[model samples]
Target: MNIENYYNIDAQGQIVSFTREQASSFAKGIAGDFNPIHDEDHRRFCVPGDLLFSVFLAHYGVSQRMKFEFSGMVVDSTQLIFPAQLSSHMSLSDANEKNYMDIEVSGDNSKEAEFISMLSEKYVQFSSKTFPHILVPLMEQEKVMINPSRPLVIYKSMEITLDKLSGKQIELSLKEASLTNKGKKGEVRLEFAILSAGEEIGHGAKNLLLSGLREYDASQLDDVIATYTQRKSEFLAVA
Candidate 1:
């Protein structure tokens, strides 16, 4: 497969692009700093978290084909050891000499080590949705399409809370379908209905259901679906 299509391309051959706002927000989120240093016009600098998220996104590859096998692929969990430093205007450039994945920053070794430890823990917690699996399928189904993308609906276990007003156990039904093709822009449409115990609770139009389905774990797909479907059938039989 072509690796080039696996990521967002940049002139510097990196996988992601970021704006000053994004960088600033990342720094603020991780460091808990509302300082002006990270702003475009501010003299303050970035915190450990900013560098961690940026480098992670920069190195990770995401593409249309990859999205298809979203939860099937696993990332190298060891490479996320540390965070990089950010001061001013900076961007990623291809490092052809290095065969291994490592984060590089412009601080002293002690600072680097300190930040690395903090960032590693942060990423492990933040990457919950992406750990060990790509998670593209679940995202696609939940957000892009009303129907399941894998010809199956999987769950560890689904519990219905009837007393809850939010309607915990609900099924989405699709309505009219549409397609659009314009260069790199491809489109599809699906209408949906929310049902609980065979009773309609809500209905709506969803454009991003396909993207939500991408986050599903491949191994659990079939087992989860079978269990849920069987339970639903039994409930119906009793009713």
Candidate 2:
């Protein structure tokens, strides 16, 4: 995983900017995310959140336990800086110090490039599948669906804890999923396991929010999923 291919950084190691194409490409090609919000032509185009996670790992490497909370969405050409040292809590922010992600990390950290790269690719692959593959079914089970006309699925936060830190090939599988609804707002929690050589090595949880929820309308929701799938297929066909 060549993380530098996804974002631009200066000689001093400060992330300089991301073009819309870079963001869109990273979302589709690297993370397998086809969210329209990340599309280059979208009205509210923003860099894929997973790209930031990858950059952090690319710079600071992986930790035994880590958590990330997204506070704001990033647009093109925004400058970002990572701390030179890790702390119990850290912020990934811009030149103005406007924070986008709040990070909490503890336990020993590994700066091994190979391990970090593999873990990043594996983790993003799992995170990117939240839409139709995981969240749709969970929504159906909860008897709710996000608004089709103005669907808003937010990347709220994610965390992981590892029992060990060495693996060449990493894999992930969902172990549990649940959703808690509060009127039109809801939180979807996905718990997954990290597997190496077919054995559990770590566990993680990704939490997302869905706004403008409504009664489950199978046909309408299916249309949304279909649209997303179609976009992915079309992109691949052209790529």
Q: Which digits, one per residue and each the tens of the lDDT, describe model 2 over residues 177-207? A: 9999888999999999999889899999999
**lDDT values of the candidates?**
0.32, 0.89
Model 2 bad stretches (over 4 Å): none
Relative to the true structure, candidate 2 has a C-alpha RMSD (angstroms) of 1.1
Worst 10 residues of 1 by lDDT: 62-71
Error of 1 at 36 (Å): 40
Candidate 1, 13-123: lDDT as tens digits: 433433455545443433333323444454433322324333443343111111010111112121222114432223333232322222223212222332333322333
What TM-score, to 2 decimals, does candidate 2 have? 0.97
